[model samples]
Target: MRITTETVAAAMKSALPNKTKYHFDDDLAGFGFYRTTTGTGTFFAEFRTVAGGSKKRLKLGRVGTLKANEAREAARKAIANAALGKDLAKSRAEGRAAATVARLLELYNERTRDKRKASTADGYDLIAKVNIVPHIGATKAAAVTRQEVQRMHGKVGKARGHYAANRAVAVLKAAYAWGGKHGHVPEGFNPASGVDRYREEPRERFLTDAEMIAIGDAMTEAETIGLAVDAGTAKHAPVGQRVVMSPYATAAVRLIMLTGARLREILHLRWDEVDLERGILRLPDSKTGKKLVYLPTAAIDIIKGLTPIGAFVIAGESAGTKREKPRADLKKPWAAILKRAGVSGIRIHDLRHTFASIGVGDQMGLPVIGALLGHSNAATTKRYAHAADEVQRRAVEAIGGKIAAALGGVK
Candidate 1:
């Protein structure tokens, strides 16, 4: 008999205490009313998503909550979807799994963690926590629009500066691309694409000879006499009348100035990577892949002075643990040293630029400077060409002066 209100009510009344009863609609193949032995009646739909596939039973509300006609329409839609080879239950489950953008980001980070470098993974996590998630995390992953992403980019650019905003968008783009490819969101969907990036001016600031002298003096003071602060008298206190700095951090800075190596390269340096006899570092991996850094005598001396702690040359706090890690950063020690030196607007990275600029000012050829800096591309070293031109102009001016004086004497 057709599962109408009358049939469902009759089935519920006739449902034996020891047995269950079911009534199917005459016109609809899979729509039915089910009565349990406890006399509770519910509407249900049963169908196979594919031919010969296992049948799926979907509960369509209780008898009184949903009239028979209402349940029949729902069953018809579900049956039609099943005929199109769509698994409604599975689709609903997947939608719930990545319902929100925050959930999607969490899945993206967890899945892609092993594929990225530790530093890169950490940067992505920071971008999500500090930038991306806070803005659009509550939005549905499937419903995020290009307009929303563009708006987010604009806000970040205004608040955090262009470079930081650009980095955050880059991570967002990667996350969306990964989600689309992996079926978390709709395939070929990416809201982060085509968002205009803010224009960024590259930093050209480098230290002069006087500034270098000041920094050197500061380093000496930190290692020996200790820099004076306004707070307490503790040896390692950040706020203290006199704070003696970490020897490892001081050495790391000295190595950066002398060797022109990147910050991470020095911080993550292992003892096995050092070749003191040859005065070179055999870095297994760097930003530019495997790198070979030739060390001067001064850099070698700094390395020799350091006491080895476990695997890393510049020892982090977890140096002796089973999972030994490199020094997380050089921010604190660099700040103290800069304050003591009375230097402003000088970043740690500027030390690398200073090394290259000095070489160029001394008339070292661009190719030689490039090689010393481990630059794979000659074009990257071209920024120092102006310094070389200045050196040439000075040489010509001196030559002209001497020539004019000799000519006057002869006359």
Candidate 2:
């Protein structure tokens, strides 16, 4: 008899006690269903691994869970795989025995700890926790599909933003690549390999001269008379209350603006790396590896004025203790200063961009700007090309205005 929906329903209804009956599609030899005496039924595909090999059964699903056409399609694929010497049942069983994606990620993290920077490893762990592991970590590493990774990417993009979603997929791709290299997964089987990533636009924010003056003024006020806190920001404080900022944090910001150094480079700066006499920072390591940061007089003055609290130039509360550490971040002080200065939509990193813009405005040349910013790649500093063009345009405009004025003082 043919194993269609109606026949399966009839078989389930007429099933006898303490007995089992098997029915199959006459047109498709391997596609069939088995009904138990208790009235339960399951659909399955029974096929030989090869032309004359022993038979294997791959369960499609229960009758109600999977419809007739769906089961038939599944059976066809199973049979096709069997003809190719692939046993679907054995592969599924082996997948069940393989390490889960979470386990693979754990191993990947542990094995690559020494190879990755501490901050980089921490970032991977964060991405896994916040995005990846929560979604597909339980699936067997070998069985993870591209569709699953794509879904995760789409979901993250919808909830978070494209930037965050892209970061999540990037970490997943790296994890899978690492897993493949280390034999934790099949060498050529990376689920995230072909998944399309979200497009990301580079952020461009430069501080204008007026804005810079405002920020500097705000920093000075924050250190002395204190900046007023926004109403309702603090739980206990009344509206328009004032709070003094940390001297070290203010100095750190000034140094960033003056020297164009990255937040971490300045925050984690140690006394040994500084040379007051030479006006240079002998950084042993930065994002671009070992580098020399020539300091301006203003930058040197800011550093010299800071009272050393610990090994770190910018000291946190835990400075000078057994757990001596640099300042964790300058979020609070930076925010207050921006609010006081009426500046919005600016990040601390933007200060670095502002520095590059200033250098371009001065026609310092891209090479000099790149060297000062410790950019190992010329492409990175090339982002400031627009600023250089703007400066040149203004200069040409000035020359044209002079010629025009000399030609006509009548108008």
- Give Cα-based local distance difference scores for all models: 0.85, 0.85
List, residue by residue over 58-131, the lDDT tens digit for candidate 2.
Answer: 77777886788888999999999899888888876565448898887788778888887765786678778888
**Runs in model 1 lying further than 4 Å from the true structure:** 1-99, 109-122, 134-139, 143-160, 229-240, 409-411
Candidate 2: Cα lDDT at 344: 94
Give the per-residue lDDT of model 1 (tens digit) for 159-181.
Answer: 87788889888888888888765
In candidate 2, which residue pairs clash? none
lDDT score of model 2? Answer: 0.85
Model 2, runs deviating above 4 Å: 1-103, 116-119, 129-148, 154-160, 228-241, 403-411
Superposition TM-score, candidate 1 onto the true structure = 0.72
